[model samples]
Target: MTNPVPKTAMTMREIRHQLGHPVPPPGVPDAEVLPVRFVVSSVPEGHNARHAYTINVHYRGEGMYSVGHGLAYADGDGAWSYEPSRSGEDDEHDADGLTWIAAHRFELTTALRLARRLAPTLTVRGRSVADVLADGSPTAEGTQR
Candidate 1:
């Protein structure tokens, strides 16, 4: 699938600045600051295969802290074809997943931002965000970060 968000490459300093983190003065290295990374994945077979897209926000030193996913189907057949023409897997589907992703370019940017903001909160004490969300508030269980 075509990346909904434009692929980006930024240094730690640039990323911190973009995310509103404090920027160090000149000559101050950003080694302690984690570099921000963006990732995307799309699979045509999931429940929302028609519009399903995954967004991942990662920090070099901090690991992945945020993930956002959604399935947004276009009206009618949309602009994508699931034909798999090159690979000849199916006539109905665009054999190249990139074709489908390219058609859903509108939804990626927001997902990236949300993932970035929530990334820092992904790790609470030692448990995962999924764990907390699935099990209820950590404080409710007497857990503290």
Candidate 2:
């Protein structure tokens, strides 16, 4: 078997750039995925944009974030998006373009609010997304207990 190309984790810069491109995003060369909070939403799943599209909110380190076009576009198998890495290091997947906000514009709540506005059906890991930023994973920042 041929050796792999050796993947690298995506930086926020790369993700944002990919999203804005006019053509199409790349599919080959798997990307490393880092662990972070995520939120999901969708109007409906279909064959077209208006009827079928999903949005995802991904937390970047230090209160930064990005909104992806469709369940992150390849977060599943066979495509480009990524699911969070099991280890804090990285995940086996892809990181395509994203519309990311600057670190200054989003704290936890701010990011959540934006995602909610975009998709009223917002959810976090199947639980109520309200106050999800209050507490959870080791990276969560806010009041304790």
Cα deviation in Å at residue 59, candidate 2? 1.5
Residue 140 lDDT, candidate 1, scale 0-100: 27
Who wins the TM-score comparison?
Answer: 2
Off by over 4 Å in 1: 1-36, 39-91, 95-99, 103-111, 114-143
Off by over 4 Å in 2: 1-35, 42-52, 71-105, 120-145
Per-residue lDDT of 1-145 in model 2, one digit per residue for the tens?
9999989988655876778734334664445566465644543232122222345556667655555545442221212343343443332322211221222235556555665565544444563333332333132232232
In TM-score terms, candidate 2 sits at 0.29
Query: Candidate 2: worst 10 consecutive residues by lDDT?
Result: 94-103
Name the Cα RMSD for model 2.
21.3
Cand. 2 Cα-lDDT: 0.44
Give the TM-score of each candidate: 0.23, 0.29
| Candidate 1 residue 138 C-alpha distance from true site, Å | 9.9
